[model samples]
Target chain A: MKALKALSTSVGSKYLVALTGLSLVGFLTAHLAGNLLILLGPEKFNGYGHALISNPLVIPAELGLIGLLLLHIFKALRHVLLGRTARPQAYTRKVWAGAPSRKSWGSTTMLVSGIILLVFLVSHIATLKFGADYPSAEPGVRDLYRLVVEVFHSPGIVAFYVVAMVVIGLHLRHGISSAFQSLGLMTPGWTASILAIGLWLSVILAGGFALIPVWVYLFL
Target chain B: MKVHLKVWRQTGPDATGRLVDYTAENIAPDMSFLEMLDSVNETLIARGEDPIAFDSDCREGICGTCGVMVDGRPHGPDSCTTVCQLHMRRYNDGDTIVIEPWQALAFPLIKDLVVDRGAFDTIIQAGGYTSVNTGGAPDANAILIPKTVADEAMDAAVCIGCGACVAACKNASAALFTSAKITQLSLLPQGQAEASTRVVEMVDAMDAAGFGGCSNEGECEAVCPKGISLKHIATMNREYRKAMFANR
Candidate 1:
């Protein structure tokens, strides 16, 4: 109860949001690495996928990831609601307090991008993880590579995936540095580097993920 | 010089307000923003109309008594300057300047361009002081404070309690203001005794005042008249986290 009370404050809620958000970013990094294994051909990709799902710890990790995502959403939604009430009246002619202020399209539209990503996440899991399960030639290991290839074969899905990745990039553009600030890890000496990393990391991760579907749609 | 003014006019807190336009004429470029408003108010009074209401004191910018959303930016377009100190030269003739009160739930609009910053006072009263008592002023050498620590403390202490940070924030968060207070006290030897209780109580008071959470956008830091760095906010967060665990 004490911890919960401590975490419910404006400062504490932000701390939790930052912690969960950065954890999700960590999960994304691992996920992207795993997804990129598709480039190694079916044997390598399927073997990797099979190895991952077959591990006993996989289910617990997946559940933990789900818990983290839910908590992130809960805290983020609470923030948006609180923001609305904080300034009951809107400014008639608000302007961005330009540079040195990190206000951006990404920062402003984080809620929108996040909501979009949530919808994309559900559709993504349904199509790939819970979609058609074709048997592998080696047996036991579901042909996840085939499922991925088949999914990417659709132009509509490939286009959608690319668009979703862009939204993810938009979320991360502000999220990375923001998380550090929320966690109190940001300092004058490290602020500039953190900002740069937030921008480049978002681009690298989103662009890297986006390339996969495009590469599959074209070459595979 | 002349400029077009679209100033917010509200009779009371519950009254619906709107921007009423008036032309400010015969304005000198050297005049401060508040002085220009004085010229406009003079004209309105001469015309037997209610003059635009705003707040100002110590027009030199130290009192932190004057501020308004001038053309959508708090304290006008200048950086590290308050509204009372913002010069009219920043504007061109015929420029349409829109002024509005600080719009935050914690800062209720009391008139045309003045909001009650009582929430800040409430936060301060919660824990912005040290309980240490001394009967007389001690010699400067009595406290062997490091120059860097003293400088850092002074930097945080420069915050004039202006609510511009809240006005500039998208979330209308009081983090910058509260953080400045927390950091200034936490860094000093006198502040060490109550450090844990101070951060916890002040932060709780800030949240209870209906201020939103910080998004770390740095808009507050950018708009701050005293150039209060966002580092103080980081320092505050560290203090808060430490207080939570230590006090527990």
Candidate 2:
């Protein structure tokens, strides 16, 4: 019975969302760390990228990361679908009040922001991983370092990336703490602090990602 | 005080509704929000027009019957008070108030501000109870409860099941309303027997009724006439999570 409950489609979707989302947040932290290596110039950045690709567990780990991302998107889209079906007919003169009225502009646009991030991720992997045209520092290795410098040199691409990272920042502001609340990881005493942490973490992560692009574009 | 009003009017369950304009004049400042509505209805009645239908029972705010979105706020502008308890003096002399029903898919409009809240009752019926044998009651002290736990449970117990939480929620989720019942019983010793079953059945019923999932906006607690805390929602999540691991 417990297993069935665990397996039920609707039984624990919210917690599923929270758990998967938190892992995705973890992935973002790791990815950000890897991205910041670009600030050290091509040799270091490409070295890190090459090492990541050459690791023995890379294939399995990559597959696991993909699974996590899929689950996160799946649970999030499920909530969106549920919310839509729950109110088939739109309200005529609807207005927000109390806490509902207190939503940030980013909180209100989570779906759109999330979709933007999804598009950015696919294009990002394609360009940085498979789309690199330059050769490696050592023979027969991919020169991801050259690609990084060249790509950030473009004004349009930098602009796109800057905007996307900020949206990610905004999304995380509400999302991280909200995931905690969903998972019941809150006490009255900790509520404000949890939310505060989410906000600060968002600013840091977004700021970190945004810094890399601008740095590569100008200083590099 | 005289006020301009745009009230929603729907003839029946199947009828499409729109906001109809009316001017209320010579309204006394001491009158309640519902009384102001009565004055407007009176004018329409004098012209042989169908009176605007609204719900009000126990106009003291205890019945959870009188509810409307006054100027886009549920139960009017006064905090922690229902429409019946809201006074006319809160509005300016020539203010235009946009009155609409508590709109949600679960609570469909019957007419005007009166929605069919039968969905709430259905959810309650699904579990919201213990299966203690029906007979002479046991001594109250037989199941001793701590003061703080009892008080917090009572706090959750105050929900009027008014559906204001649903209407106030952006997603139209009934998590607050449903959680109130779950938290109320799940805290009591007598309710421990069926705790697992109750949470599952009630949540299932809530989902089946087409209410949206809770995103913890906290609007329900803010707009609640009873000032029900979001702590109950946390308790509910705890209960639901436990049920997932411990029971079917």
Candidate 3:
């Protein structure tokens, strides 16, 4: 137990967080790319979704993705809680010096956003992936593509999705650069490139995810 | 130039303290902040009052002996310079400056503008050195360290053990100071043999001394006299993790 606690505080745990986080980001990008196919209308989009879910390799991959997400969030929360416990006086002081340097506002708020994202993910999977209220059977299936479109048609749902995506964007913006630095990849020349890539990835993920709801509500 | 000063005054370590106001005039812009305080002390001595007590020695900024909170900043308004290196030009002629000792549980007030930074020395003594022998120093080229590794180690070694990093931290964390020492030694071959013991002892000492854990606020780097990077903290974290597993 002491070793476990020490592991959470150690630098190796930082790498674990970074690697798991990177995998999650990669999943988000691929998921968003697939979702964007909905813009082509039901036939192309639903068929694409059907094709993906039906693929022989996809079931295990999805399960693996879920495992990665859980592990990433678990480790992140552990680090956050340990960090908080280590310094309980932070919130009371309006000003403090000698706090750890190299921390950013985005990095500090990651756990909050991650929790919010978890809530968003549960609602998302429940409604669309589980086909809870959709008019269809299990094997042959209801058209998940149409269900997604209908969900996005509601302004409230659309707004919630947009807000969630914004949180995700903020999380990625900090998490990406920090992950690389934690893995000992921070060279001066490479730092700018990594940061730029991280920023671009964040913008694309957030913008892409938010676009789905906006497109369905406005045009579809 | 003239400035209004609100300096903390205490008769001794056990005495109560208060902010005392003084007007300093005709201060040269080129004089470092401590030299200005020296001028003020000269006046106080002439008037037969006890002069303000502060810590300083090696006024060139390398000794890490001088530090004060000026206008709520650890080492004045500079980004990465010590109090002894900060020039008066950074302030307006009539500016009111507040100066006080490093405020932390571990750094008790020794007097006005000087706290007992002995806690840091204690932490250092706990594990900040290598056990390598001093018998006939090894050849300079014998080590053959990579340029990158040498440069990084040198960067960590530049830290002067000043508590400016702690004074600047919101949590008063000793992460920067402790990490700098850890990284400096960990990067060399001579220090490798005792690395695991060094990390565990140093970290335990840091905690036992009541220094707060790092919150990653980055203020320490901003006020570090040597511009020590936060990368060293990350490095220390890595070392501590390795030590834990290796020891177990």
Q: What is the C-alpha local distance difference test score of each model? A: 0.92, 0.82, 0.78
Q: Which segments of candidate 3 are over 4 A away from where they belong?
A: A1-5, A10-16, A43-105, A111-132, A136-139, A187-189, B5-26, B38-53, B98-119, B134-152, B169-173, B200-218, B237-248
| RMSD (Å) of each candidate, 1 decimal | 1.1, 1.9, 4.8
Of 2 and 3, which scores higher on TM-score? 2
* Candidate 3: count of backbone clashes, pairs at least 3 residues apart or interchain: 10
lDDT of 1 by residue, A1-220 (tens): 1778989888888898999999999989988999999998999999998999999999999999999999999999899899889999999988998867888888999999999999999999999889999999997989998989989999999999999999999999999989999888898899889999999989989999999999999999
Candidate that scores best on TM-score? 1
* Winner by lDDT between candidate 3 and candidate 2: 2
Q: Estimate, for each residue in B133-241, the C-alpha lDDT of model 2 and write its tens digit.
A: 7789798788899999899789888888778888777777888888899989988887898888788888889888988887766778878888887767777778888
Grade the docking of candidate 1.
Answer: medium
Give lDDT: candidate 1, residue A1.
Answer: 19
Pairs that collide, model 1: none
- DockQ of candidate 3 compared with the true complex: 0.17
Clashes of 2: 1
TM-score of each: 0.98, 0.95, 0.77
What is the overall TM-score of model 3 with all chains considered together? Answer: 0.77
Tell me the lDDT of candidate 1.
0.92
